[model samples]
Target: MTYIKERRRILVVEDDIDIADLVTIYLHNQNYITHVAYNLEEATKLLEQRRPDLILCDIMLPDGTGTDWIRALRKSADLPVIFLSSRQETEDIVQGLELGDDYITKPFDPDIMVARVKKRLRPAPSTSENMVATGENVWRDGWLDLHFDRFEVRVNGKEISLPAKELQLLFLMASRPGHVFSTDYLFERIWGLDNWSDVRTVMVHLHHLRRKIENTSSTHRYIITVRGIGYKFQAR
Candidate 1:
């Protein structure tokens, strides 16, 4: 199927001129609109002018580390960020993940990077629009209500906030109630095929999601674990 996608805007923040140009070239070839920033200062300036759909950043910058910049960015925006740096240490990768959506080691393949960027920009697939819709762009099942346009979730009329990845995961499962999603499926769907991270990441996020949405006192659980398989939303 030939899918037509809107040109996604991407901000590439890398001090290395050659790397920045290389990334921008690849992204442009994929039909993405890109703005290159040599440092965090320039990136910040560009952000003030226009917000990009995604950000590609390097950890070491001329003015400050990308980690520090991202820490500050998180205070205001939830823009998906992918770290493109040479830092391959376990600690560095974990730290990047803690702040951003994904991390990529330096000297990365342009093809893989573009693929990851596309995955991040793509919206979660829904089985049927009417199946999930209670209202325009809204999904409701009993006390759980999800507003796709606003990225808001309300349980029992009280609003609850979730991280971007968790929200996407919930939307995917809840959109197709009773459909079992294996760990591999969920990982690839939410984290993307370019992600080499362990599948255990799925388990950790599921645990946190369950805690947020599941009402222990009630017999009804929003998300049900299909042991030895994966997980599914409890059918109404």
Candidate 2:
């Protein structure tokens, strides 16, 4: 009997040939379709050919820094990125975190890298099964209305557009109002089941989401941070 595997395409952007080959071998072992790009130029060509499910990038490249590449890519693409680099300094890690979804220091374990990749590629939970319905793909709470199918949110009849990730985060929290979600839980549920040590990913995305949905003048916020815990949706 033969079993066919679902290949999740991954773009590996690393200048070092040995490191790129090693990472590609590991990703292939995990049944992922891996494409290697030696620099930003090569990566750009590969991206034009086919968009990968995720990107594993090195901070230092022959042509330019990964930070610059991702900054430009984010303008058009919403693909998840993980930074794998030898630069483990606080500032370097913070820079990677700000630009990408996840960051890994160099001399990393192959298993851990594969795990992170798998998590990023994990399919989102079924919206139809889990979402609380107002009507069709819509979920409503007074002035705040979410149209999941349309990926549109309306606040007091005013429609606001959000990035894909931000919109998903809002839908998850708003679906279960008053339910407090821990960083780990939200990370796995929303971002996937990788390492939660770097919870900053959740914070950054949530901050962006809040900016879009939260009314500054209003005393009550739609999404409330639970201090020591995570966050919950509180409709006012």
Give me candidate 1's TM-score against the actual structure: 0.51
Q: Model 1 misses residue 204 by how many Å?
A: 60
114-216: candidate 2 lDDT, tens digit per residue: 8988887756445454334343445555567777566689977799888877887887676444546788867776667556446688889999888777777
TM-scores for every candidate against the unseen true structure: 0.51, 0.51
Off by over 4 Å in 2: 1-5, 124-236
**Candidate 2 TM-score versus the reference:** 0.51
Worst 10 residues of 1 by lDDT: 126-135
- Which is the leading candidate under lDDT? 1
The residue pairs that clash in candidate 2, if any, are none
RMSD of each: 18.0, 18.4
How many clashing pairs does model 2 include? 0
Candidate 1 residue-wise lDDT at 44: 93
